[model samples]
Target: MMRSLLDHLLIVPIVLPLVVGGAMLLLGERRTRLKAGINVAATAALLATAVALLRRVNAGGVEVAVYLPANWPPPFGIALAADRLSAAMLVLTSIMALCSLVFAIARWHRAGVHFHPLFQFQLMGLNGAFLTADLFNLFVFFEVLLAASYGLLLHGSGPDRVKAGLHYIVVNLVGSSLFLIGVSMIYGVSGSLNMADVALRIAQMRDGEHLLLQAGAAILGVAFLLKAGAWPLNFWLPPAYAAASPPAAALFSVMTKMGIYVILRLSLLLFGDDAGASAGFGSHWLLLIGLITLSFGALGMLAAQNLPRLVGFSAIVSSGTLLAAAGFRSPAVTAGALFYLVNSTLALGAFYLLLELIERSRSYGADLLALTREAFGLDRLQVDDDDDADTGDAGVAIPAAMAFLGLAFVACALLLTGLPPMSGFVAKFVLLSSVLNPGGLTPDVGSGVPASAWVMTGLVIGSGLTGLIALARMGVRTFWAPSGRAVPRLRVIEVLPITALLALCVALTFQAGPAMRYFEAAAAALHAPHDYIRGVMAARQVGATAGVLP
Candidate 1:
């Protein structure tokens, strides 16, 4: 009985938000505080639930816990599976959601009506995406999250946001169309939407069936890659993210990761070593696109004039890094990538929230002043269509406020650039080490290792250096340049979330040994996936609920 009750906890992360979000919708927008309080309680519960699942998964040692929501066995009923990978993602999502929520309460929440409900529903979709084991359900959750994001992205309306939001919507709708088509093809071929069952069918399918499966997989991969913000497919991302509200942008960071997560899950499950003809499918493409995306994001960052766009490109950089790392298909490398994903996400979320407050310090008059001087031929006049106004200003900087901005800015820069004394550095070190030294620490300089590995090495190092240069310039302009800018008042609600996120990164650095061990274990499970298959395929219906649903 106790075990059954514990097993049911798997649904809490998905169900809690859904219930709370629906309730908030009924409350309307007038009682903002009441809605916020409910959101806070519900989000905290999600964090607790995610952590509990993480603990349970860790303690179980390569186990997968499956929750049958309708009390029917899969390939039939809705199945939510919790393994190390899913559990870890749940925890990351909940953490970021919580931080974004707290930060929003300061001001971002009131950007428009239905903020609380939309936010909760966004959580619901995100949680559902991570937890669901069915491809159909994956698409369902994808639409759920994407739909919520449409509202959240446009929560605070402006000319730039409206324009960007339209592009965002059009692109995702196309991706959704592609996603549905791919799922349909796979279902027609395999006759199952359950991921494990699909994998089994793909593994056992004939050569003719293999061709159809591969084609569908390719189509599906595009949608995931686009969502992951890979090169070419990701042009809409930077602008859209830049125009989003700070809290929404923070959560958007993790939303991008959901694409990477699904890509990894499906790529491994359906086309892993067990699938004879399709083994290692799309690996080269993942690696190639990842490297290209990295370069693109780096170049974009170098060219960005304002913090928002800079952070948007930085997000693409993070996405590119994860994709390339996962493309390696080495579990050791995967462990590092997992570590990178968590730490980078924390940094990015903090950076987005920090951008809002930093903007308050910028003097709007400064832009006009620069233009006036240029018109008088006292300064050079040049403006890029894509670039926004400069953050540079000339005036007295306040002592205390400037101090906090400087420190937090430095922390975000360190983490984003993968520099020393922070988790970003640790994540990069793990990635490079795993890639360069799969078995041992030292390699015989260009002997026996693939050229691809070397290229990945160069791209990772180059992007970090590129990011460092870009962030350094933005920092100097925002913090050190002479400023007519006012000292932005810091709110406790606003400041605490950023502090907490960075502190989590610090904690991750300190806890690196244990974290790496856990990631290593997860990587092992992911690569083999025998345990995952058994967990999902062999899931049972509870006695009392069996007849209830049937």
Candidate 2:
């Protein structure tokens, strides 16, 4: 009974949101409070289920759990598998969705006709993408998310959002087309859509088949890279994210991560050292591209004139860092990267939410003043009227709301820049330390760390420095400069979500030891795919054996 219950729990994260979303579509828009209650309840349930699933996997000493939709075998029927990495992702997605939904209820949920339904569907798609064990299902989940995102992107109905949404839709559509073509080619060559079966078949294929598989994999990689916001392929991300409403932007932070998750999963499982000729096929290129993306993100951060775009670029930097670290193929580095991934996503999401509030506090003349200061070489300290006089005393009493916003803004800046005394700092330190000393005190000592690793280390530090400078400049402009603006009024609902996320970051910092251990275990599990394949395939075998007995 317990085993069956746990087995059913594996599918709840994927199914719950889907059912709720369809139900929400049937609810009338007038019942906003009812819809919100249902959405929040469903999200809470999903989070609880994800937590339970993670605990089960950890306590049972099992690395993977497989669920067959119809008790059919893998090559023919759909499969849903859960591992540490996927479970972690599901938990992260659920947390973000719940927080974003609560924040949305304050105002943004009423912005459009189907906000609740679209939001639920988006969660459904994201959960599905993370849990699916087959490449074709992965593509299906991608489309589901992308379609839902198109609606959410334009949820508030603004000119900026509409324009950006159109561009976002067109780009993703093209990527989707490429995704299908790649998956089709792989299916043609290998005669399987199940990832485990594909990996098994690829290992036994002849040289001719190897070339075809590589081409298909490359095309598929391009689609993933585009979604992952890689340097040249991600021009649309910043603008689109910038234009999105706050709640939508917060959720979109995890969307880019879905691409990273898939790439990491496939690259390690299919192209590991055990893949014969394809071993380490694209690792070097991933490292190089990752470094370039990191540099591009840093430059984008420095160039951003507003907070939203800055947060968007921060997402890119996080993605680049993860890709580069994973490219190293070391479990320790991967563990550190996973820790950093969680830290960065939380920090960036919080920053996006906080930015909207901060911007609202700016004076009506703030933009004009900035333009004048830049174009006409006017001094910011000069006073235009007696009411706007600069006291230069530095002893003015700060409003309670302004003080809170300032503190939150500082926390976000520290986290994004990987500064000391925060999770971001600890995450970066672990990653760099792991790269330099993979053996932990023994040190390989013979070959030394690769120059590419050295380059990545420099990029990591360089990006942090760049982010520090950019965020500090913005902070001074927003918080310190005499803008003659009143402190923005904030509601409890608006402030609660941002505070919750920052609190999580602080908690992560204090609990770094145990958190890092969990990620280390996850990375180890990911690197060893045999356990995963065995567990998935054994499920089908057990079902087959049971059928024969009956």
Candidate 3:
């Protein structure tokens, strides 16, 4: 019974937020302290749940939490499931959400409805998206999160904010609509919306049905790619993320992840290796696109003069790198990508919170670098002993916090650039190793592995070149340049989140063994969809048989 209880630990993270958000609505904006308290407690609870689940998953196998909505049969009802990968993502997202929430608490103003509630709802959506086993439920959760995100994105409601939010909104809506249409078509074809069931059906389909499956897969991939901020389809993300409030921007950083998560999940659970080749969509295409997008993002980062825009472009680069890892079609690469994804989210969340601190130090100026310089007093390249040591070191006073945040950000930069001592480095290393290994893409002879290997090397080198150049420029301008202002002190609230997120990055590095193991499990599961399909169909068949006459 206790084991069974642990199985459903996945739902706790999502449900806690929804409950908190709903309760906070009654408290309204008047009870600001109450709102803050609720949000902090709720987010912390969710984070704790995630941590618990992560430990359980690492120790055991996949931790599944099956919550059948309306208490219906498995086939007839929706189920919320959490595997190792999903649970790991839950931890990452919760950390991001918690940081953003803390930042919002300090920055919360008289903005109509309480900011905390919206934040909670958004968390609900994100957690739900990660945990859902039913495809339609995933869509519902995606929309739930997307709608909440629009509110958060447009929180300030300025002209630029409105414009940017609208673009994000319109693009996402189209993507969501496509998602719905695709899910419907999938159900029509497979007669089941459960992911495992659909996988089973797709495997047994005739050539004609296979074509339909291919089309559906393509459509699904397109929608998710757009959300993941893949090239040609990612035009809206940078502008919108840049335009949103700092906390909102931090939240959106993880939002691009939702799409990537779906693409990965679908690839692993539905398409498998066979689909990648048979559907005429080789994994190489993902690798090529990831390379192009990585290059594109690096260039954009280098070119952008504005701080927010630069961060936005950095997001694009991060997404591209992760996608490239996914495209490699190697479990080692996928695990590496997962490691990078979690690290990036944590590091970027800290960066966003730091950006907020920088903004506040300047009385909320839109000019990021100028504000950065003003806040840190870094107008010139050199620093003097008279200059406040805290400001020069990015406004963090706690020596450990400053060091950790800096180290984490630097690690993130290196990982994004494919550098060493970091998982990003290890990820690229594993990927390149796999690609270049004498064996090919096939497990036996390792045929075609050389081509993919070269692709990895080229991407790693290219993204690194562009990323390093851009990062060096940004670092000089933002952190090293001297300004005319003195370093201002940071509030505990502001300081806590950055410290927490940075610590998470360090923890990820140290605890990488468990993370790597989970990623391997997820990757292996993705490569072989047989277990997932078997589990869900068996559940469905058992339900149907239970209802039938003997």
Top TM-score hit: 2
* lDDT at position 126, candidate 3: 90
TM-score of each: 0.92, 0.93, 0.86
**What digit string (tens of lDDT, one per residue) describes model 2 on residues 503-536?**
9999999999989988988898888888777777
lDDT of 2 at 437: 77
lDDT of 2: 0.85
Model 3 Cα lDDT, one tens digit per residue, 1-550: 1236655576687778888888888985678887888788889889899889777756654434345544566567777766677878888888888888887776543444667878888999999998888898898889989989988887856667789888888999999888888887778778888887676566577877777776777787888889888898888977888777778888888888988898888877776755533432446667777878887887788788765777778788878877877776667677667777877776666777676554432323445434333324433222245554556646634334334434545655665565766555655564565556524234656344456567657766776787778767765654456354334445688778877776666666677777677777876766675655544444322234432211
lDDT agreement of model 1 with the native: 0.85
Taking every candidate in turn, the Cα RMSD to the unseen true structure, in Å, is: 6.5, 4.8, 5.1
Off by over 4 Å in 2: 1-3, 365-394, 540-550
Q: Give the TM-score of candidate 3.
A: 0.86
In angstroms, how far off is 393's CA in candidate 2?
8.6
With candidate 2 superimposed using the best TM-score fit, by how many Å does residue 187's alpha carbon deviate from the native?
0.8
Give the candidates in order of TM-score, highest first.
Answer: 2, 1, 3
| Pairs of colliding residues, candidate 1 | 393-482, 394-482, 394-483, 394-484, 395-483, 395-484
